[model samples]
Target chain A: MTDNATRDIEELIGMMARLPGLGPRSARRAVLHLIKKRALLMMPLAEAMQQVAATARECLACGNIGTSDICDICSSEKRATGEICVVEDVADLWAMERGASFRGRYHVLGGTLSALDAIGPEELRIPKLLDRVRAEGVTEVILALNATVDGQTTAHYIAEQLEGTGVSVTSLAQGVPIGGELDYLDDGTITAALKARKRF
Target chain B: MTDNATRDIEELIGMMARLPGLGPRSARRAVLHLIKKRALLMMPLAEAMQQVAATARECLACGNIGTSDICDICSSEKRATGEICVVEDVADLWAMERGASFRGRYHVLGGTLSALDAIGPEELRIPKLLDRVRAEGVTEVILALNATVDGQTTAHYIAEQLEGTGVSVTSLAQGVPIGGELDYLDDGTITAALKARKRF
Candidate 1:
């Protein structure tokens, strides 16, 4: 066949194959589904994607993603509980949000401190988080880091850094394992962690 | 906090909530995931989505999605094996391709002839398929439609229509159940169905 009309589909499948759980076969099926449901699903999805592409930006102050510099949690006066819940990434932050009880603001660390991967605190938003804690008068800094070795190490380091800052440093409870992440943990685990919080 | 950012995120959540199998909770998590993986996954996905959004079009011949009028299968002389395997949709055609056994051309019927849904043969690509069978000198017309009641009904109608065309009418076999879709069935089911070989 002349290779003209198939290019778009081929390209779509190529990119979709790169998704977390999708392979080339699944990608092809998904592409076909989107096209068939073009007017209802695909067209709206395309429009939403385009709008998000154009407008999406990371919250400059707290690392939360929004179309603004300061996210709602960071700016909301009601959210200031003198506590900042630190998380590894935005997904964790979203998970916490689903619990619907944590009225405190969030501090997205972006990632953990990993020497093996050569990732340092500087590479993450650690400095930014520290700055927020100090400027926002955060009294309690809750390290909701993953239970991984790197996560614990990062938590310890942060607690040490804020040793003399008059802030109560604490970490989530031990329900999450040595290598467990909040994303994988259910809502109950997260809630229990928040309730049975311990001093670092 | 200003309403713009909150509105934006709410809008995003609303859009994401509309996706198949994804609720408001999953949408929030997914959006957060996309943001965190912005560099590695989101940006490329966005770019690809943009390109696809601009270029995607339906194949005029077989109703398969493509950027051109006639699809790759219809335009290629190698695919015209004097046999046309008719499927309920492009997804079925794709499943057949994954098997890599069928070397003949395909005719995507778009959907089954659903009387309950008021879907007629005209709504599907039945007319186009008949035209292809005649114009391409097809000797064997394989009814690869799904094993649903409507699918069988459509297949019977097609077989009856081609009765005087001197073409041998056959089906994928009884391995496919009364309401089973070829897409959801495994490769083994497809292989068995193809192997059993029975006259329609």
Candidate 2:
């Protein structure tokens, strides 16, 4: 290969290494695999990425990512069930959708509140979430944030903000995960599960 | 997201999951990371992959993957040192290059001989390597094949084929690996290391 061509291969590997789960060694392996399956995978992946890049947009009403100004959940009449599930990111919203349990729409906060990072309600979609609750006549707002300190802090702040809005504020139940071993369960999770034990 | 948009995202994730080191979960994380940094990573990765897919080709003489008919090492004057390090694949050749100890060109076999799979000398770059040895006045044919059964079998076959070609054939020294503990060494490796013991 020429110098320029070699550089291009290296550049691709470098970009792949920047992904969340991949490192330099795996990046090289992946680049080789892509090169080996060029027509079948590499080209198609490139086209797909470009297609998404060109069309993907954040929803106007919620912070959900989609291909239109208003995301599918926000636009779908069936999803306006007077309840909204709040999440920290689009990945979390997708995870909830995958469960197929909740029929309500979602509000993506983009991130949690971080005092040291100088992130406040303004930095997140807190104001937009508040507006959506009132504008859409949402009867309940579910805080599905992570159990981390920052996540709980942000959830509490949102709940306090919605205290007078007539919408009931709820959060996901904390317990040992389904199929979890009691011996392996953490102290906090065991305590929570025990405190919230259900009656047969 | 709409069905079509959701399908696009899923399609991309599926393709990513097909890569060597990534699974469905890691692919989702990677895709999300790419989407989050669309301008910085996703678009650039797509463009780079497309560029490589369009340009990458197998070196006609050595079977190395590159952008031209002949790979960089095959075409470089400095690399034509009358010695060719034979590796099982381009990845192995790349590993050698990264080590930077070899000053000669390389011959990538593409794969090893496997009777169960019906692979033979013609299935690899054996013929091209033979022709190169004669044309390039190669003094040494270094077999850098893996220690696996198939790799060793292929190396022996190549060494036998070059018996009367006036070229010296050699294999890499087998010993305890760098930073490897003797206590953790496997039996075969330990035996090989002992058999090949040298003066300090």
Instruction: Give Cα distance to truth, residue B174, candidate 1, Å.
Output: 8.7
Per-candidate local distance difference test: 0.77, 0.91
Model 2 earns a TM-score of: 0.92
As for candidate 2, its clashing pairs are A1-B71, A1-B72
Per-residue accuracy of model 1 over A1-200 as CA lDDT, tens digit each: 23643665677678667654456776777677666666676666656655665667788888877776777777788988998999988878877887877889888888999888999989999898888778888899999998778888999999988889899998876666678889999887788778877899
Report the C-alpha lDDT of model 2 over A83-186, residue by residue, as the tens digit: 89999998899899889999999999999999999999999999999888888889999999999999999999999999888899999999989899999998
- Candidate 1 structure quality by residue, lDDT tens digits, B1-200: 24565465566667656654456776676666655566676666656655665666767877765566777777778887888898987778878977889988888898888878999989988888888778878999999988778888999999998989899999986678779998899887788789986898
Whole-model alpha-carbon lDDT for candidate 1? 0.77
Candidate 1 Cα errors over 4 Å, as ranges: A146-153, A172-200, B1-6, B13-30, B36-55, B95-103, B113-123, B134-136, B146-164, B172-200
What's each prediction's clash count?
0, 2
Positional deviation of residue B67's Cα in model 1 after best superposition, in angstroms: 2.9
